[model samples]
Target: MTDASGRIALLRATIVVVAAGGLRALTYRAVAAEAGVSHGLVRHHFGTRDQLVAEAMEFAIDESLRGSNMLEQGLTASEFAAGIESLADRESALQSFQYELLLESRRRPELTPLAERHYGAYREAIERQLGRLGVADPALVDLIWFALDGLVFTQLVAPADPAPALARIRSLVESAAA
Candidate 1:
């Protein structure tokens, strides 16, 4: 594999390892095995475990935002988070990896910045969406974000059909603009 692709593969492998077995399960050997590469390659790419975990977290956050259409502009409230279910289903491991990292930050103080960045991305995206819909209040945006956050968290932890709840959220969002 090329250098860039190989590195991203390692990042993805890191996500899967953490998702399946949490942070403790992550090691150069584990990521190497998951990526089908040598442990030395994993080390060469990331240099340290902290770097590996941080890069993986950032990658997952970007990918999750892109896939969920959360950062895309011009979407109405009904259109916001339209493909969330599919994104969640397809990228459950990625989602779990992020949650693992977020929770891990509680124990490992060094991870706080990345954890904050992760949430900040979601908040900014929500702000943009709400802004387009003429809902400019930060407090209202935060409330909506919390509700949406809880919705996704519940779906991930419990595995449920989220269509009804999602539809309700969209309805509320649309009416909130009126």
Candidate 2:
């Protein structure tokens, strides 16, 4: 395959794998079967399962980044609530992919460091926002982090809407600040 064809192939395979959800032990054969391509083609682009997963996870992250423009500006209290809403939408697309990556990382310790790095960037962004607000409570910041994770999980699992949760968090943060 040409370079463009190879990238399109991987992109299609990634979409299938993500839609399949939590395919922890998925092989190149599985991906190739889904993509209707030869197994060798899958292996050609992603040499190992880890490499495939990494690329898939990166694809999900890139999708998540699509809606983060609102956060580029310094987030005020209300703006932060909107950011959470945007992020919840983003997380919904990639939650299963994230879950599988984390589970797979247990056996493949090499991937653990990459996970940490991804999570560290998440924490740092939150910390930077808190710093902008002049909040000194590391404990509170941790609570917000936990709350955000819970929000993502809730949005993923429950049938309820996220607007109420987002509103409640906004109120909580505003009240705490006041």
Candidate 3:
């Protein structure tokens, strides 16, 4: 493989390992095994486990955000909910890995800033959406975001059909708009 392709393969492998095993459980050998590369190659690319975790976390967040297309114009609550549901269906481990890193950040101060920055992007997107809907308060953004987060978490843990819950959330948001 070319250098770029090799790097891409390693990065993909890193994401799978971290998503499947969490940051604490990640190992160079595991990443190599997932990537079909050597452990030395994994270490050469990432240097350390922390670097690997940071890159993988960032990649996961970027990929999820990209898949959601949340910044597109004329977004609706139902559409947003559908995006969430699609994420749950397609990349369940993405959310779990993100939450795992977030919780783990509480114990690792160095990770706090990265987690906050990643989460801030989601918050900012929601805030923009709420703002477009004529809701200006930051608190309301927080509330709406928390509601969405709760839905995602519950879906992850309990594995339920999210349509009804998402509909209820859309109703509540719409009612609040009135």
**RMSD for each of the candidates:** 1.7, 3.5, 2.5
Ranking by lDDT: 1, 3, 2
What is the C-alpha local distance difference test score of each model?
A: 0.84, 0.65, 0.74
In candidate 2, what are the lDDT values of residues 1-178, reduced to their tens digit? 7867775667556656764656654777777877778888887788887678777776665555445532355667666655655255655546656655666678889878657755665566666666666666777777766776677766666746777776776676665555
Choose 2 or 3, whichever is better by TM-score: 3
RMSD of 3: 2.5
Clashing pairs in 1: none
Q: Per-residue alpha-carbon lDDT of model 1 for 5-25, expressed as tens digits?
A: 999999999999999999999
- Once fitted onto the true fold, the runs of candidate 1 whose alpha carbons sit more than 4 angstroms away are 81-87
Candidate 2 collision pairs? none
State the local distance difference test value for candidate 3.
0.74
What does candidate 1 score in Cα RMSD to the true structure?
1.7
